[model samples]
Target: MDQLKYQMVIQWSDEDDCFLVALPDFPGSYWRTHGDTYDEAFANGKEALESLILAYESMGDNLPIPKVASSV
Candidate 1:
């Protein structure tokens, strides 16, 4: 699957003292995963997104349309 088509939002949380990752296109929890560092959060987010796609496919559900950036 083309994972890049989806958007991944990563932000650092001072309360958690870690980086939080969110897959806005997947539709579920606001924050899907977290990591101690930015790189780790990115890797974890990618894995979570791939798993979500497979889960949706296995359940015979249509995947969400990826949002694209509009030209300014």
Candidate 2:
């Protein structure tokens, strides 16, 4: 859901030749999914986040609290 404001870290990997997406809120793998372009990476990251939430719910695990950003 849009209400879940989890942090998504998108970075370009020269060696991999693609954009890597990582969900800091969710533990486990450093990189959940990736894409060839930034746009693709963003979309993939959203899908991955949804899947991760579903997986945690199905497994009866508590979802991690989303980190909030502070304004300067």
Candidate 3:
């Protein structure tokens, strides 16, 4: 299987205790881990993405549905 790449944006959340991870291309697919630091959150997010990707692949499903960018 080809290596799949997905962007995981990690941002600090003041109201929340954990690091916020947002999958820009995948809506409603965000998760947070019990982390008090940025690095911890980033690490957790990476693990989360890896698991999600594996699950999808195991089910024979396509990962992110890349959109075709329109040129002006």
Candidate 4:
């Protein structure tokens, strides 16, 4: 299957002392993973994305539609 392009929001968290990652496609859930650096956060986010897709597939669940950015 073609890879789904999910939106990943990575931000620095003072409280957590690390870069936090959020998957908008799977809302309402807390941040799945974090990293000490931006690059690490990005890499972890990609891995999490793939794992999520595989999980939903194994459970026969439909994947959420990726949010598209609207040009203003």
Candidate 5:
């Protein structure tokens, strides 16, 4: 089974006119999704994240575990 730890955060993106989803500690893990409303965007973001995780796991490479969030 795929085993990796991550968290999802969905926020509004005015510039994109879509939802901006991010994995706070997973750098470069983000996606822009469209939906009828904000709530749908959040839901879509979750699915997008799940798909990404699965794709990475299928690569047979070590899954990077997120430890903490940072700004540098």
Candidate 6:
């Protein structure tokens, strides 16, 4: 959801030969999922985000605060 305000960054990786997705707001490494195409990568990223949110809620853990961009 837009309310979460999590950043999803998708980029092409030469080494992996696929599009890599990074959920910067989440913990762990930048790379979370990959896809042969850009769209697939995006879909995978969304799925990953949903799973993460559910996991946190089920554990009764506090979710990470979303970051906001400054106008300046």
Q: How close is each model in CA RMSD to the real structure?
A: 1.2, 0.8, 3.6, 1.5, 4.4, 1.1
Q: Report how far off residue 24 is in candidate 5 (Å).
A: 3.3
Best by lDDT: 2
Pick by TM-score: 1 or 3, better one:
1
Candidate 1, position 71, lDDT: 100
Query: Which residue pairs collide in model 6, if any?
Result: none
Q: TM-score each candidate.
A: 0.93, 0.95, 0.69, 0.91, 0.59, 0.91
Cα-based lDDT for every prediction? 0.92, 0.96, 0.69, 0.90, 0.65, 0.91
Error of 5 at 35 (Å): 3.8
- Expressed as tens digits, the lDDT of each residue in 1-72 for candidate 6 is 556788889999999999999998888887999999999999999999999999999999999987778999
User: What C-alpha lDDT does candidate 2 achieve relative to the native structure?
Assistant: 0.96
lDDT of 5 at 30: 57
1-72 in candidate 2: lDDT tens per residue?
Answer: 888899999999999999999999888999999999999999999999999999999999999999899997
Candidate 4: regions farther than 4 A off: none
The 10-residue segment of model 2 with minimum total lDDT is 24-33
List the candidate 3 regions with Cα displacement exceeding 4 Å. Answer: 1-3, 32-34, 65-72
**TM-score of candidate 1 relative to the true fold:** 0.93
> 1-72, model 3: which lDDT tens digit per residue?
235566667877788866787666555645534357888877787787777778888999888864445698
**lDDT of prediction 3:** 0.69
Better of 2 and 3 by TM-score: 2
Summarize candidate 1's per-residue lDDT along 2-64 as a digit string, tens digits.
645999999999999999999998877889999999999999999999999889999999999
Kindly indicate the candidate among 3 and 4 with the higher lDDT: 4
lDDT of 5 by residue, 1-72 (tens): 335556667776788776666666444635545555778877786677676667777887555576755798
Q: List, residue by residue over 19-56, the lDDT tens digit for candidate 4.
A: 99999888568698899999999999989988998999
